[model samples]
Target: MADFDVKPSVIDRVRDRPRRLQRLAVLIVILGMGLALLYPLLRDRHGAPIEVRDVPRLPPENLAVIPLAASPTDDPRRVALGRRLFFDARLSPLGRSCGNCHVPASYGTLRAARSPGLGDQLDEFNVPTVLNAALSPYLGWKGKITSLADQLHRVINNPRHMGSNWAWVIETLSADSDYRSRFSALYADGITRSSITDAILAFERSLVTPGAPFDRYLRGEFGALTSEQIAGYELFKDYGCIACHQGRNLGGNLIIRFGILEDPFKDGFFDAATPKSKRFLKLRVPSLRNVAKTGPYLHDGSVETLEEVVRLMARYQLGREMPEEDVRRIVAFLHSLTAPLPENFR
Candidate 1:
């Protein structure tokens, strides 16, 4: 070897240039494919295309909840597959399905105040309904997540929710020929973490229950709501309840601090064992849709009856304890928010 002759000749450098470029190109392709595969697992963090408040001035309240929307792309085949995935128990490590807490019979949420999770632990926050959840600005009781796509990861991994992560979820789902076939039909990647979550999102977005009497009333069918219910609607706006709770899904679009004037959590509503810091504030105002059926109410499932829920809202959100009669009127109005599932969904 020449001691001072280590440098390659210009010809040698030129000859190696294409090899270097080829390796770089291969690396780029590998990385791109890896990202395409990984996109679903990380997609939840992308937030929403439009912020909750930025959603185009929603159609008239009645027109907001249209018949179950034909998925985002209006693909019936994809949405149909998603429906099966939505109810499949194999999605979880413990075999408890998403339907375990959000039963369709009870309007996408269970009757339990705080939904039961794997083992004996009850979820810390209430299980909000999947109905119209896509319209929500944020998901979770605290409104931490922004879009339905993002929340799927949280739900799948949260110990109190699906109680499983991609490791087991992917292997389990990938092993099923039927599930694999469904995923393949809908997604080129097939049975991936992202595809699985996306399918569920499609199904959930289709879960909207339109044609409720209240929706009809909003559509100019003046007689859809009763005299009492109409009066209750008046009271709802008069009391400023509409401020936080008025949107396509009523309350899901806004985040209202749970206790503006006073802390409902400070009262006996939450168990003393629960942390005091988590008690109240910045909570996603839940949708009033089908609220009558989705009880016990609140993030903790503390209140048992809708009547009491009205009274508590008056005391906490409004800072004035409402009279039984006024609460009665408001409860009647809230009932108008309930809508039945479209026939196909039912």
Candidate 2:
């Protein structure tokens, strides 16, 4: 070996490297300990835990046992006025009424996925039935509006729905001698935007669906539902549909993002152009009381037939592909939920 190479062995250099690494390791451990000690202090400096579940469900007295609604207000005249306004096409500048989209015969959902608004584009979401709206803890798919009155105001202003400004709505209704007189009589403070909302809300509250076959079954009417319907009800509960869709209206107690079990929106079930938050992927659970009539099911109106809806829910909500026979039976059961329209609604 060369003399220079023999002067310092490779092992000597390796030993020096180990010492350097040990010093660096010690420094890193010290730094870690300091961060661990300061972590609690940093965490405590920020926000406290928030209590979120304080809001209560609508009181029992306010809801119908089957197709739930708020208990009728003491003012009958206001409700009567509301009913007239509900059917009046004059509420819109385009001569369209609420019934134009929310066909009472169709369980409140619009025939098309979206109804034409003021613009060329269709409305974003399906026109949910006005039936049982009062039973919901919050309004709209996102639960944005809290009260029926607030919802009415937003819809009137929404160009796609009512397409009228506050001033125009007030002026339009005020000009109607009949509407102005009605508003004056119902509201203590006289006609105003607030009074208009009150009248509309009063009518909405009156749109209740009662005496359905399902209601009869709940009331111990053994023959109200056929054997297939009974089987479907069993499947509805057994498959965990009752977990989210329960209570009087059969839904609307809580806001759950859609596609909890599977991503239904991924397969083009909803409009991709809409914001992610506003898509059919997120929604409040809808009432299934009149599910049969509410055709073109789902928020995007992707599934038209009740059988398809049942299968989709089974696959998406339950995470299991349901058999066709099972789906058909469930559809039969859903049909029982369709109560004869209230005489007043007719």
Candidate 3:
């Protein structure tokens, strides 16, 4: 055989060293990037560990849902004052208050398909419950308002809602001795629109219902849910209901087209003449917490039963029909989501 050297010369070895180092550097960079991307997903929305009852379980990163935690720091006094204002009918010029539609006993919603507005006009969408609403990233069926304070202001001023402006709200509230006293104690500015909104928002933030069976299950209580509900939960994920409906509030964080796979509104109230931009077609996915009690369901409140809602969601959102047994199990899982109203809800 011809003499052939298998080993590279010293010069070749030196030349190859930088290439090897470059490849190793690239690998390290890729790994670092991956970890950086995954770290945020592993943490909850607030960048805190996903915890409930001091038990850290599946973070929003892993499960697409986080356990609801108690808001222990909420001021009881502020909550009380806000609760009082919430139910008072004087907030609206028409004598319809927030509570008129967002009834506490009804899981913060009304039974009507659409609530009557300030005048003869009826609201275009269903009333979503205020329970667990604090966990929602977006508010209202349209998902237009980002802040609770802004939502309150818009409702107070919207012609279809309170039909009143800041001036009227302030004047109406300022006349009340009790409100005035509470305002003075809680806020130095007292009786301003900002103060009123702050108080109401403080109360809204306190409306956290953290003790649902599903929440307990997430907190490490494995047996909190019944076997059927557990089966339903697995089915819920398997059927892709968890895609949009995830997070602590489950569905509130997302704004999706009403009919993603098939048009739920076609041949119904929404015709081709309705603009694509219209809210009737695009809406915020509502929270499922206390969903069993907050029906009539859907944005238009067209579906009356939870079972029907599940079937409709499967058809319209998932582009398929679920078996009756699967629907029953999913509904059972949803029932596990129901939590008691906050103690200060009334």
Q: What is candidate 3's lDDT per residue for 44-122, written digit by digit as tens?
A: 6545543453345434532487788886565677778888888888887888889888898888999899878646777
Tell me the alpha-carbon RMSD of every candidate.
22.1, 9.3, 10.0
What lDDT score belongs to each candidate, Candidate 1 first?
A: 0.77, 0.75, 0.83
RMSD of 1: 22.1
* TM-score-based ranking: 3, 1, 2
Q: 2 or 3, which is superior by lDDT?
A: 3
Q: Give per-residue CA lDDT, model 2, range 13-52, as digits (tens).
A: 7677857788998999999999999989877664233222
Candidate 1, residue 235: Cα displacement in angstroms equals: 0.2
The regions of model 1 sitting more than 4 angstroms off are 1-73, 343-345
Model 2, CA-based lDDT = 0.75
Give the clashing pairs for model 1: 44-150
267, model 3: CA deviation in Å? 5.0
Model 2 segments beyond 4 Å from truth? 1-74, 268-280
Best model number under TM-score? 3
The Cα error of candidate 3 at residue 14, in Å, is 47
lDDT of 1: 0.77
- TM-scores, all candidates, are 0.77, 0.76, 0.79
Pairs of residues clashing in candidate 2: 108-129
Give the Å shift of residue 38 in candidate 3.
25
